[model samples]
Target: MVVEQFLTYLQHEKRYSSHTIQSYKIDLTQFGDFILKTFELSLTEVKYVHVRDFMVTLMDHEVSANSVGRKLSTLRSFYKFLLRENIITASPMALVKAPKVPKKLPVFIEDTKLDLLLDSEELFDDSFPSVRDKLIIETLFGTGMRLAELLALKDADVNFYDSTIRVMGKRSKERIIPIGKGLAEQLKNYISLKTLQNFHNKTTGLIVTDKGADAYPGFIRGIVQRYLAFISTQDKKSPHVLRHSYATSLLNRGADLNAIKELLGHASLAATQVYTHNSVERLKTIYKQAHPKA
Candidate 1:
């Protein structure tokens, strides 16, 4: 019951996305099961030592540090909630520390490679599916929206005359992302094709499957991976990479950091600041190649 109450708080008060709330639920449930079985205690009764033992069990099972860290984070939030609600007199997670995850720079396809892929007329045919796929790629790179945000996009979200799209971001925050003329035209064409589909019960979501069903997560991921493979050899070809590419591209082109943060709908500037490292790396590479001093 406490878990359900915490989840309700997350959903209504915190406005966490459903997907995120689900993850939190899974994490809490896993911890609850662990504590119940191992320590003969419910979630609120677990102490710091019990949490540490759980961490040891996870490590013993060879779970990746990143995953173990996430589980710990979930416990931290749950315990915090319990404390706030007076369900617990003290917090056990106050003593726990998350593992330090390795810092890897965000990966992005070069702008030239992306341009080559998007501009190649032979790659995207005139058919509805083909055109629709192209628009999906364009929208991801053009707007820097997350996959969930893209899927949540509705027909009413686009303003053709204003060249803007309002996307629902993390915590149900809504922000308007400006679109380029080329992408706007592409969207218009895709909508025209979608309108001609024979499905009687059409979905209002902006992007859909060839069968006119609203696009799901796997469907969108497959589209991004399939298209990105032609241009990038990086192991990660997910939609988030396009989001990174969009941010890096803007930062490289001299867009202000705060502006990039707003466009990407980041909670803070620190998330947007990572793109600056990519730009600095580029400058270093250029200097190495062109400078006279050996």
Candidate 2:
């Protein structure tokens, strides 16, 4: 009952998405089960030792540090919530520390290859599906929006006259992303084609299936993967890769970090700073290849 209430708090007060709330629920439930089975105690009775023991148990099972870290974060949030509500006198998470997660530069498609893919006239056509597919790639690479943001996009969110698209981001935050004239034209054409088809169950969603249903995660992923496979050999090819590509492309071309943060709708400059690593690596390669004195 307490767990359900906490999840409701996450949903209504924290404004966490369904996916995030589900993950938090899973983490909390697993911890609850662990304590009930081993210590025979409820969540309210947990202590710092118990939290540490849970961490050890996770490691013993050979869970990745990244996964363990996320679980610990879930516990921290849960305990914090209990403390705030006076359900618990203190949080057990004060002494708990997350395992270090190795930093990996984000995977991105080279601009040249992406250009080749987008510019190839034979790759896309005027048909609704094809135009829609191309626009999917363009919107992702052009706006740096997340998959969830793209899924939530609606016709009303777009302002062709202003050359911007209003994107609803994490925690219900909203931001306007500028669109290129080319992309705006593409969006105009795609919407025109979609209206002409006039499917029986069409919605106001910006992107839709051939039958006019709102696009889901799998639908968007499949479309992105299918198109990316034609040009990119990278193992990771999703809408997120396009988002990374968008950020990297901007940073490489000297866009300010804070500006990129706002454009990407990142909550902080730290998140936006990762793209600088990509730029630095590229400069190192240039130095190695072109420097006369090695």
Candidate 3:
């Protein structure tokens, strides 16, 4: 009941989005279930020792530090809410420390391979699904829009005259991103074809299933994974790699860091700075291959 009240606080007072609230619910529910099984105590009887023991059990299960840290953070927030409501005398998670997580660089497909993949005749199947899939891949690679932003696009969001797209990103924040001439032309052709097939649904959204419904995340990911699996042998073959490719390609071609930061909708230049490392690694490889120091 206390956890339920805290969840309501997160939903109403914090105004957390549905997706975020669902994640919090899952974390808390899992923690609660674990505590019940381990300590044989009800939610009302949970104490600091129970919380600590649950964390140790998570570690014993070989859960990643980052995952454990996130779960702990969720618990900490829940307990903070309980403390505020006077349901508990003290917060158990206040003294707990989250594990440090290592930062990993984003992985991307090679430019030459990506070019070959895009230019391959297999991509031009002339089927409705094939064309739609190709356009999605091209758009993501060209613009670096997040999956949600790409899915949330409407027919009017793309301005062919201005070569720009209006994307709704994290927290529903909107930004304009420029599309390349080639990608614009492809999108125009796809849109024309889509319209002719009566798949517009009158909803004004651009991306849709064969039945004209808005595409879901699973549907989009399945299409991306299928195409990338055919073209790439990399461990990471998803739409996000296309985003990485977009940023890295821009950096490789002398685009300014600040420009890429704005285009990618990154809150900080530091978040955009990772691509610089990718470019640096590429330059180092080129130098080693072409230099005559040997």
Candidate 4:
């Protein structure tokens, strides 16, 4: 009953995305099932030893440390919720340490290849879907929006007068991102054409399927991958890679880190700093090109 209450809190109060809430639910349910079967204890009866035993069992089953750590995190959140509700006297998940995950630079596609992909008219056909597909690639690379954010975009969210797009991001936080002249033009053209194709349906969603239905996750993923393959050999070739390229390009183009953080909708500077790798050389180039004092 309390677990369900926690889920409700995540949905209504926290405004976590459904996918994220589902992950939390799965992790908590797995732990609950383990406790019930192994120790014959309900979640309220769970203690530090029980938590440790669960972690050991997970590890013994060859579950990655990352997964085990996430499960512990779920428990930590659950116990903290219980404590706040006065359902528990003390928290047991505090003692568990998160496993160290290896740090890796974000994988990004080269700018030159993306340039060729978008500019090469021969690569894309003249059909509306083809044009729509090209716009998708540009939108992802031009805007650092995550795939879900892009799919959820509504026609009303695009403000042509101000050259900005409003994005609803994690936790339902809304942020405004400015678009370039070129991208703005592309969006205008795509909307006109998509509207004609979708029975005047394009006004409902910024991006839509062939039948004019709102775009879904798999449709966007496949479209991004299909077009990205033309230009990038990177193993990733996902919308997020385009997002990485967008951030990396801006940082290289003399944009400030905080500005980029706002553009990417990152909640903190630490999250944006990951894009700063190999910045000095790019900064030097941008400085020489544009800095008056240089």
Best by lDDT: 2
Candidate 3: where are CA atoms >4 Å away?
8-15, 40-48, 80-90
Per-model lDDT: 0.91, 0.93, 0.85, 0.87
Rank candidates by lDDT, best first. Answer: 2, 1, 4, 3
Tell me how far the alpha carbon of residue 203 in candidate 3 is from the true structure, in angstroms, after superposition. Answer: 4.1
lDDT of 3 by residue, 196-282 (tens): 888885557788888777888888888888888876887888889999999999999999999999999998999999999999999
- The residue pairs that clash in candidate 4, if any, are none
**For residues 123-198, could you state the per-residue lDDT of candidate 1 as single tens digits?**
9999998998899899999999999999999988999989999999998888999999999999888888788785
The whole-model C-alpha lDDT of candidate 1 against the native structure comes to 0.91
Model 4: lDDT to the true structure: 0.87
What TM value does model 1 have? 0.97
Off by over 4 Å in 4: 199-203, 278-294
Could you tell me the TM-score of candidate 4?
0.91
Candidate 2 contains a number of clashing pairs equal to 0
- Ranking according to TM-score, highest score first: 1, 2, 4, 3
Which of 1 and 3 is the better model by lDDT? 1
Local error of candidate 3 at residue 9 (angstroms): 4.5
